[model samples]
Target: MGSQELEEEELVQMVRDFIESESPSSPSFSSSQGLGTFNQQPNYLTLQEILGSVEDTEDEVHQKILKYLRNKNTAWKTTNLKKWLVMRLRMDGYDASLCRTSWVTTYNCPGGDYEYIDIMMDNDENGGVGRLIIDIDFKSQFELARPTTSYAQLTDTLPCIFVGCETKLNKIISILCTAAKQSLKESGLHVPPWRGTNYMQSKWLSDHCQKVQPIPRISSNNS
Candidate 1:
């Protein structure tokens, strides 16, 4: 495997290690509780609640990140959004050198094309530098030529995608869903019926990532 692919594998291994270490070995039950009874589900904060919490944070860096993301116009541009995200990641304790924007990697597509990753992060400490590619969608309307690669081609190429994110502001989830379905047609993957659900899009993108070749991280030392 190339350096980039090796890096990604290392990241996956690290995640597996973390999960394994944190997971409980066995379920613990109390004799006093009835057998039929179950533990109450933990209350999770909703998206709005999480955003509200960030907005109300006393930390300067947290507030700055939230303010930057809340800027509607700035968030619409992929370049601007990437810069802000990289900054936020740095503030959140990620290695700045590992996070890159406008990362270019050549793929042997139909006519030989280049894939520009909006934001790529290589969190692995190994010698390899395979990054996790993240694609951001901010367009309010879906265009036929939205992606440089066609839906038919994406079935063959999009598997390298690590994450696909859409802006919460002024975004129509239905339009995004339509685009996703078109891309998955040739890949033999199916989009969930609930197009509006975030989980559906995440699952689809993740599935695509699993199918494509791993995109290697560009060497920073090489100009």
Candidate 2:
């Protein structure tokens, strides 16, 4: 193999070994111990938990969101889109809401706020309700100005829109941050604080976030 090809292979192996070492002994979620309400402290997830098969409900919800997007007639601004989806999902008997997360500039990372949609649904997993995070622009979060071939391939696997639970997102951030660090080092670039794992985690998992349930729109006849 060429020198560059050898380097890419080495990078892949390094990531694999790291993830293997980080794999947790217990699964992230199960029927018996379902992912509880968002108010509960989240369980830390590992490589194995993320690599496992997608839960049936997660897949179903994913498809449903895709269908909703596909059927929409008008282009939507992010704020309006989130509000509409929140109302739509709520009308469908799903406990959905618009969530906004903000962070302060820390020594390690910069501060920022983000908006996304989430649903608390009992996805037929033995009547367990789980919070599913929905990001319309999931893939873009991991984009790099100039990425190594190996790193690019890793990111290409991410869905344009992400609809999954905290456990799944945790593992993704861990893997991507590591890849991004190596890619930046190879390119002789400084890794930005925003691209770090902690920063990315705060976008979705921070306790300081605000979750707002949209007030239902009333018709004129109601007055």
Per-prediction TM-score to the true structure, in the order listed: 0.23, 0.70
Candidate 1's C-alpha runs over 4 A off are 1-68, 71-79, 96-130, 138-223
| Span of 10 residues, lowest total lDDT, candidate 2 | 39-48
Which lDDT value does model 2 have at 92? 58
Candidate 1 lDDT by residue in tens digits, 79-195: 333444554444554332222212122231111111223233343567553332332321212323333244322222111112322342112244344556665564556544433
lDDT of 2 by residue, 91-125 (tens): 65667789999989999989999888888877574
Pairs of residues clashing in candidate 1: 4-130, 159-208, 159-209, 159-212
RMSD per prediction, one decimal? 18.2, 13.7
- Computed on alpha carbons, the lDDT of every model, listed in order, comes to 0.32, 0.67
